[model samples]
Structure formats: structure tokens, C-alpha cells
Target chain A: MKNQLTVILAILLFFGTAGFSFAVKPGEQLSDPKLEQRARTISKGLRCVVCQNQSIDDSDAELAGDMRKLVRERILAGDSDQQVKDFMVERYGNFVLMKPPLAVNTLGLWLSPVLFILIGVGLFWHVSRRKPQTKKPIDTDETEHRLEEVLNKMKKN
Target chain B: MKIQPIKFLPVIILLGIGIAFAFGLRNDPSKLASTMINKPWPDFTLERVIADQPAFSREDLHGKISLVNVFGSWCAACVQEHPMLMRLANREGVIIYGIDWRDTAEAGSAWLEKYGNPYRKVGLDANSRLAIDLGVTGAPETFLVDKNAQIRFKVVGPIDEKIWTEQLKPMIQLLQNET
Candidate 1:
């Protein structure tokens, strides 16, 4: 009973921390129109570093919220779109961007589909070319005759 | 041909490694990777705070190697990171600018007072518009802007002594050399 309770408590704690970790409530004040526009532009392409399949603008994760706020501040302070992207990249790497730029580190990510197609083709070729082992069609009479001949030949030899 | 146990061992090991790698990649919820550094800085103007006056604007950022910190009074991490910010502000050629994102003017001022006022300029992004422009999701993020107004480095989380000694300082040095 004690062990069961402990397990339940541990699970509760894990979920509680997870929920607390990332939850972006709407800001008390509406965001500035001009700055908001600029922030969105940068965020649309930035992946949520903390959440699966979410851009910073769409994510509620703490890190995503932080990234969004940072983008706004920089825009108001006077940063350009490229500059904002550059900033995110420096800290989080190219993976933070939804559209990762062409670079050596991301070659594997970019070429996966093409590589997978080639592998599929190679497997198909190997399967198709395999040697077929055909079974000989034998009648009962033929089998008996062959057996008699084999026995006579063995005796003669 | 007979199958060797040793050959199967190699295959099994390779399969295990492949499965482990795929699982590891999928398990990480955060896909953090550095994207763009060595890019131009975004441009904007903000109101700066001072003892007895109206707030200032982007003109103040001219001709300096500056660090732009997007933080807010409401952010817990901002409070946590204030001291490290103070240390960085004290360094030469390192101007710290604060963007009080999504906070009221009164609250923003109170936050600065409670913590140290290390920012050379404090811009009020009362409306979340400014943060949106910078692609900010939330607060306590930092960007390193060069003398030419290009962004050199960015630190997503709080800046600490370890980050300073290893990542930030080295980046600053690289920028220093480039210019």
C-alpha cells in the first residue's frame, strides 16, 4: 500500500511540474501593433524549442513564451527580421527555426526523404533478383522406376 | 550458408544502436539548435527611463556594443537573472538595454527599483507588439548586438557565471576581433 501511494505521488508530481513548466496565458495588455507584426514575422519560422511540432508563436511552453517576449523587445528596441533570426540561431542552433537554412550540420535532415527512396529501391531490386528453387514434378510410377534404376545401378557398380 | 552467432551479435548491436538513436531524438521535446548568428540586428526605437525625464529612444544605441535584454516585472527568471545582468552591465563596451515586455510602466519601474537598474535604456513594450516583432514568446531572453548593430550572439535562458566564462565571453571576444 505504501509503495503504491508513493508511485501515485511521484506521477502527480511529474505531471504537476510539467504543467507548471510551460503555460502562456494571454498578456494582461494587448501587444503593440507594429512590434507585434515584427515579432510574428520572426516567430512564424522559429520552432518551439521546448514543444514538439510548435512554432514559438504557437507554443505555450515557457521557453516559447520567453522567446516570443524576447522577439517583441528586440523589435521595439530596433532589431530587423534577419537579426532576430540570427539571435535565436546563436543560442538554440538552426533547429530552432522551422525552416532550417542550408548548412552542413543539417544535411541529414534535408536529405532523408531522398535517401529513404533510394534505400527502398535497393531492397526491391534485391528481392526481385533472388534465385527461384523450382520443385521437380514427379509421378508415383516415375518415382518407382527411378528408384529401381538407382538400386540396379548401385548393385552393378 | 550457416548463420554465425557472432555475425548475429553484430547485427543485434547495430539494431539496438539504431533504435536507441531514433528513440533519443524523438524523446527530446525541445529541439534547441543555434540557427542564425552573424546576422544583422533588427532596428527599432524605444523610450529610455532616467531619474527626471521622458523616456529615450533608439538613438541612444548608436556607436556601441550593446546587449538587449527582454525581461518583465512579472517574469520570475528576470528576478533570478538580475545579478548576472548587473555584472555584465559593469563590463566595458557592454551596454545593457532592457525591454520591459508586456508590463505596465509603474510595474516596470518598480521591478527595476527592486532589482538593480543596470539597463542604460528601458523600453516599455506595454503592448506585446514589440515582443512579437522580435519573435519573443516570453521574457528574460538576451541578444548581443554589435557596434554595427548586427546581432552577434543570443542566450535564451538566464545568463550565469558559467555561461559568461564559456559561451558569452568567447562570443564577445570573437565579435571584438571581427570589428
Candidate 2:
């Protein structure tokens, strides 16, 4: 029982810290919860230009914080979510978007998964088709014939 | 010993992957292409860092080939690139404007005093309003604007002597020749 309690406490501590680490500071959040939520959602889709991999919402970089504030400000100014995203894309290009839009440049990136799947299926089919030929089962009649000949030789001996 | 094209597929794929990685590894991920290139410079009105100087705006850049430099007193790389900018403005007679990005007016003024000021006009960008519009990720970025007020080229990091002589010099000369 003590061991189980300790394990539970350890898991709670791990998850509690994880959640606390990624949260935006109270000072930066908007007064209206709905607008703040919208800002959070929008920020999650923006790539932090300095951090490269982290979304603006998840980054502690000063630039990301400023971007988060900008998102809220835009939201307050009656800009739709799409408009906010477009605004960022206009300034920083599509690289600012965490989810890259389907466009001429990103066609290869979007289609590569399907291409890979088709290639994988083709290889599997080719291998399976050749497998049966190499591992052909012995004929029952041949096995029986060989057994009978062995029995006859034993009888003669 | 059958010479089958299919047998070479693995080798070809391996060689292709190796070549891709070789080139990809050499690429600097931090270097982002500015979307504002060839686009008109974003509109902004900024107060002058120095009290006596007039404010800076897009109007100042009109009919001129100018270098707009973004620097911060807090940024170490900007310190490293200051002498090169001084040479360009003082020696080579380049018209350079300044944006003291994400810094206090007091700090910006003090920094200019320490490092010899090389700007025709200096604007304070305490809130990064202009920096964001220019797609600036960090400090020590420089933009070359043509006579038409279009941003022609951008350098992300600190510019050194090699970049000035090789890339920016020829580009500036080319833009100057254009009507």
C-alpha cells in the first residue's frame, strides 16, 4: 500500500510540473476568458521564430511572449482566427505556421506519405508473391511413395 | 550474377538518401527567407531616439538606396557588427537608417553614444512594432532598400567585411544604376 501511494504521488508530481511549465503567465492573459482561449488556440498554431521547433504558446522566449500578446491584441481588435493567422503568415511567411498549408511549395511534403505507403504496399506484394514459390510444400503422393519404398526395403532386409 | 535493374534499387535509394542528408546538413535552419523581399517597406512612424533628431518614417527612405539596420543595446552580435556599419556609413558613404529594436529609449541613446552612431535617422522600437512587420526574428539584421522603397535584400545575422564586399556591394551598385 505504501509503495502504491508513493508511485501515485510520483506520477502526480510529474504531470503537475509538466502542466505548470507550459502555461502562459497570468500577467499576459486577457480579462475575457473566451478571447483569451481564442488567443491561446491561435498561438498554439504559430511557430516561435527564435525557438524553431516550439509553438509560440509553448516557448518561453521573449519573442514568443510578445507574439502571444499580439495574438490577444488582434483578437481584441475583432480579427477572426483566420485573419490572425494570415497576418502572421504575411509578415513571417508560411514558415511561421506550425501546420503548413497545402500549397505549390508544400505539395511534395503533403504527398510524400501517400507515395511512401504505395511503395511499401508494392514491396510487400512483390515479396509475398515470391514467398510461396520458394517454400512450396512437398506433394503428399511423393511422400507416401518414398515411405512405401523404404518399408519394402526393410521387409527385404 | 544476373544483372537486374531491380537489384540496384536499394543501392540507388541509399545513395539518394546519403546525398540528401549531405546537402541538408549543410543548410542553416536559422536562416529564414524574408517574405517582405521585393515588397514595399511596411508603414511605420517611430519617435527618434535622440531628442534633437526628427522622427523616422517610410518617407525618409523614398528615392534613396538605404540600408535599414535593426540592432539592440542588449544584443552582443550587434556590438560585433557596429564597426562594419560605421565603415559603410562614414567611409563608403552609404545611407543607413537605424531601428533600436525592443530596447528602451535611454539604453538606445547610451548605446549610440558608446558605439559611434552611423545612422542618418534612428528610430526607437521599444515594442517591436516595426520589427515584426519587417519579419525580424532577432537583432543585428540588415535590410537593403531600393530607390522605389522596396526591400531588395536582407541579411539575418551580423554582416562582416566579406559579405559587404561580395554580396551587398555589388547589389547596391546594381540598384544605384537602375532608374
Candidate 3:
């Protein structure tokens, strides 16, 4: 019984790891290992628009699967990686790319954070500079006179 | 006293962000903007879903305005839009082409038979290769193509009565007037 249980556990462990590691669907892989690797690299950077956040490489959506097939087909047709990416961009717009190119439309998206930080820093500097001007030392004589007045009032009470 | 002006900075920034969010919320996330707008439709020669029927190609789109609808037998949304497509075909008198995307030819033929075929020609995109080229991320997407084969506009989801009357009808009227 012990030996049988060990065999069953080992079989389950092997299948579990195999299933986990082989996430890419079968028949989607190219025969050429180098080309397949390139396809995977390209797919990892292509966003699955249907899922919105996951890459085509990670998504199980039917559209993502089709996109993965398209990437491989283009690569097999002798197009370069850049050409494949351009083809997708032309059809799906720049949204398909995981890392958007610095273009007219996306220029604002890439620079807004930096712009906000600069504005914040400038505001901070401006406010700090003005802070000291308004916060001058209180008149020591006035404070001492007030303290004496308070003490005298307390004695009377 | 000078710091009084600076006190409103955060509030101003927050108000700007709130306005931005309000505009963002007004946008419908389900409607994706098409990249193929104003671009020539991609060339393709797809086998007909019906065996004896002639195959479809980009050339068929010329000489008249056409609506190319991407659909699949497996897609539930396609079924919902089928009645609207039939109405468009009969009432509008415009050519309606079908791209049976990511579906079996037998299933596609059966679906058309059951739902009443609204398309003049049905192209089979068994592997969805041509559908991908057309920027079809899902089923039931419609594209309005001009006589020159340029895709003028696209609708991503089901084309209900509201979309047809409000958005597409006006666009089609304008396109019809052009040349």
C-alpha cells in the first residue's frame, strides 16, 4: 500500500508540474525552436485586447490564441519582429503593444507622471520659500507681558 | 497671508482629477475604437461556408457600399444581432457580406439556415486568420465600407436598433452623399 501510494503521488506531481510548465497550447508552437522562441518573445509583449490586461502569451482567450497564431505565421513568412509588431499595430492600433511607443497619441501618457512630479516639486519649493516669510518670530516683549498678565489674573482668582 | 493662495492648490488639482474621472466614466468600455477606420479593407479570398456558393473577396466590396459583419456560430452575441442584420439587409437595400469567423463551415451554414441568411455572400474564416487581419477581437463586429473598399466606420459589439438609428444611419447618409 505504501509503495502504491508513493507511485501515485509521484505520477500526480509529474503531471502537475508538466501541466503548469506547458502553459502554451499545443499546435501553436512552430517546428523551428528558434522561431518558436522568437514568437513567444513577441507574443509576451502583445496585449490581449479582449482580456485588457494580460499578454497574448499568458491569455487563454480565443482572440489571443488567434493573435499568437498570427504572430507565428508572420514570422514564418519571413517578416522581421518589427514588421510583425507593425502589422499588428496597423490592424489593432498601438493599444495591442504592451509597451506603447512614444508617439503623438501616447506622448502625453508617458510624460504626465514626470510633469506632475515637476509641478509638485515646483509647488513645494514655492510654498516652502513663502513659509518662512509669513512665520516671523513673535515679539518677545508682547509674549512676556501677556504671561505676566495671565499670572496676575490667576493669583486674583 | 501669502500661504492662502497656496492652500487652494491641492483642491484645484483634485478638482481637475475629478473632472477627468467624470469624462472617463462617460465612455463605454465595451465599445472599442477601430483602427481600420479610413483604411483600405484587407484583401482576402475566403472559401464560402455554403459549398456551392461562390467565395468572397475584397473585390466584392467595390461598386457599392457594403457592411461586412464578422460572426461565428459559437458566439451568442451573433445570434442576438442576427435579426438586426436581417432588417438591415431587407430595408436598407445595401449589400451585407458575412465573415464566418472561427467556426466550422457546417455549423455556419446551419446557423444561417436557422436564423434566415441576411448576407449576400458568406466567407468562411475557419482559423480566424482573415478576421484577425480585419482587427476583429470578438464576434458580431460590423464594418461600413465605402465603394472604394475603404472601411469608413466599425461597430465592435451587437448592432441593436439604437446603434443603427443613432450612429450608423447618419454616417451612412454622409458617406452616400460623398461622391
Candidate 4:
């Protein structure tokens, strides 16, 4: 009886924690079909707030879903693409977009590759200006002495 | 051989700039865009549909914490995400708005009846002018605005349960505390 009670209690505890941990919060359903389709397309461009490098469309994050629904609502309400981006940028900044805007805030993002090319060119200049050849002077006296020492060592061996 | 410091000036400067720029591009924990703690929402005027009329201007959304959704009836993914929206409507303190992008009123309304009417107010983007302004290159984007009428969070795509648990909840938490 004691063992059976313990097993039942353990099972109950496991299920209790499991139920609490993954409780489902039923989200608002989107009724407008047009708005829903619009949600998919916009999500493709927007970055996932949770996952790095993942678009909201591709992400499985909970926020991504809300965002999709929110986008659909905005579209239904008649916000344009730029307006939506501006809205998000105003809140989250340009990092939310996979493609950052070409503005003062993101100037370096668009120019760094060119900057790297310029650095490469400058490095090339430094490398190419080097002398083709430099002569090494011979130490004849040391050579002669070493040769004598080697011969003597060889003879001894 | 000794290296001349003057000759290395350009190289040093380039290295410094490259390093500085690279570091700047990095994703800083404290500066994540979506995690922006407190900021004013972006200003926008959306075309709305209320009481069987043409698009009405969404000027009244300024002072409320509201959601702006961009969607179209013809989109397939929108259908997939509909149930989730229905669920979100039941959550606390979320004011949902809708934008019907280029769809007929009959189908839009019918779609709502089928999934569930989650939005408090609805709009119609028959001409897509609002979409252009919002930088909506495609369908289905969402924004969360604060009580002071600033957009605080954005999500793009059809929603699912996982996304709600991970990304949406945190943003909701932030928005909830901001009030």
C-alpha cells in the first residue's frame, strides 16, 4: 500500500509540474483572411526577436506569432510597408530588419565592406613597394675559421 | 629590422577603424532593438473601415496601447495564423487593430466570422497606400504601441504558439510593465 501510494504521488507530481510548465495560453484568432496572408509576407523580412538571424516568418518564437497577427491588423487598418517598418524602427531600431535602412544610424553597415576593400588596397601598396632583392654579405673570415674547425673536428672524429 | 611608426600610421588607423566598426555592428545584449525598455511609439495614420464606409483615418490610435496588423485575405499563411489571433484576443490588456489589405469586404467579414473577430477596430487598405508608408514589402506585419501611442514591438509573419511563448510574451511583459 505504501509503495502504491508513493508511485501515485510521484506520477501526480510529474503531471502537475508538466501541466503548469507548458500551459497553453489560447491566443487571439485572426478572422480576416487577407490580413493573414499579408502577415506571412511581412514576417519574411522582419527578424525574429528571440532567435538570431531568423526572420519572424521563419521563427517559432511566441512573439513572432503576435507580430504576424499584429502585422495583419495593421495592414487591415491600412498601414504601408514603410510605415510599419518605421513604427518598428521607432520602437526596436533598425536591428529588427534583416536589411537595415541606409540612414545615418546604419551608414557603417552599408559601407564596411567597401572600407575593407580600401584597407586591402593599402596593404597591397605596402607589400608591392618592397625591394625585389637584398644582398647578404659573406663573412669570409668566419667561414674560413669554421671550415678549419670543422676539418679539425672531422679529423678528430 | 626596426619598424617605422610613421610608416605604420595608415595601417594602424585602418585597423582601428575596422575594429571599431566591427564592434559597433555586434549585437549588444543591452541594446537589442525589440528589448528597448521605454520609448515613444512611432506616429502613423492608417486607413480604417468602420460601419460600412471607405477607409477612415486612424488618427485616434495615438493615446492607446494598440496593435496594428497588416494582412490580406488572399494570403494562405494568414489562414494558418487565424486561430492564434483568436487566442490572443482573449489575453489581457491587448487592443487589436486590423488592416484589410486589398480584399473584398464580404470575404474579409466572412473570414472574421470563421476564425473569430479578434480586433476591436478594423481598417481597409483597398489602395495599399498605408502599406507603402509602413514599408510593408509583403503581407502580415504587426506592431505594438504603448499607452502614450508609440510602437514598441514588431513581428512579421503568421503567428504560432511557440512564438507567442518566446518572443511575444516578453514584449507583452515589457508593455504590461510600461503602463
The alpha-carbon lDDT assigned to residue A122 of candidate 4 equals: 80
List candidate 2 stretches off by more than 4 Å: A131-157, B1-8
C-alpha lDDT of candidate 1 relative to the true structure? 0.71
What are the per-residue Cα lDDT tens digits for candidate 4 across A1-157? 9999999999999988853341112353346656555655666778765564777666655555556656666777799877766666654467778888799977877898998898788878877997888787988999999999999999999
Query: Per-residue CA lDDT of candidate 2, range B61-161, in tens?
Result: 99999999999899999999999999999999999999998888889889999998999999998777888889999989999999989999999999999
Clashes of each: 45, 0, 0, 81
Sort candidate 2 into its docking category.
Answer: medium
Candidate 1 ranges beyond 4 A from true positions: A1-52, A55-107, A132-157, B2-36, B47-56, B90-94, B132-138, B170-179
Per-residue lDDT over A2-77 for candidate 1, one digit per residue giving the tens place of the 0 to 100 score = 9999999999999888644423345711277766666776777888855648787777665567667777666877
Candidate number 1, chain A TM-score:
0.54
After superposition, which runs of candidate 3 have C-alpha atoms over 4 Å from their true positions? A1-23, A123-157, B1-3, B177-179
Model 2 residue A69 CA deviation (Å) reads 1.2
Model 4 chain A: which ten-residue window has the lowest total lDDT? A20-29
Which candidate leads the pack in lDDT?
2
How much is B37 displaced in model 1, in angstroms?
A: 3.1
Order the candidates by DockQ, highest first: 3, 2, 1, 4
Candidate 3 lDDT at B127 equals: 78
| Model 2 lDDT tens row, A3-84 | 9999999999998998656648889999999999899899999999999999999998887888888888899999999999
Candidate ordering by TM-score (highest first): 2, 3, 1, 4
Q: Which tens-of-lDDT digit does each residue in B1-179 have in candidate 4?
A: 89877577777888997998799778454334343334453334545444554442456466666777777777788788877776788765467778877666677777777667777777776655555445453456776777676656667777678877897767767766775
**Per-prediction interface RMSD?**
6.2, 0.7, 1.2, 9.6
Fraction of native Cα contacts reproduced by each candidate? 0.40, 0.68, 0.80, 0.20
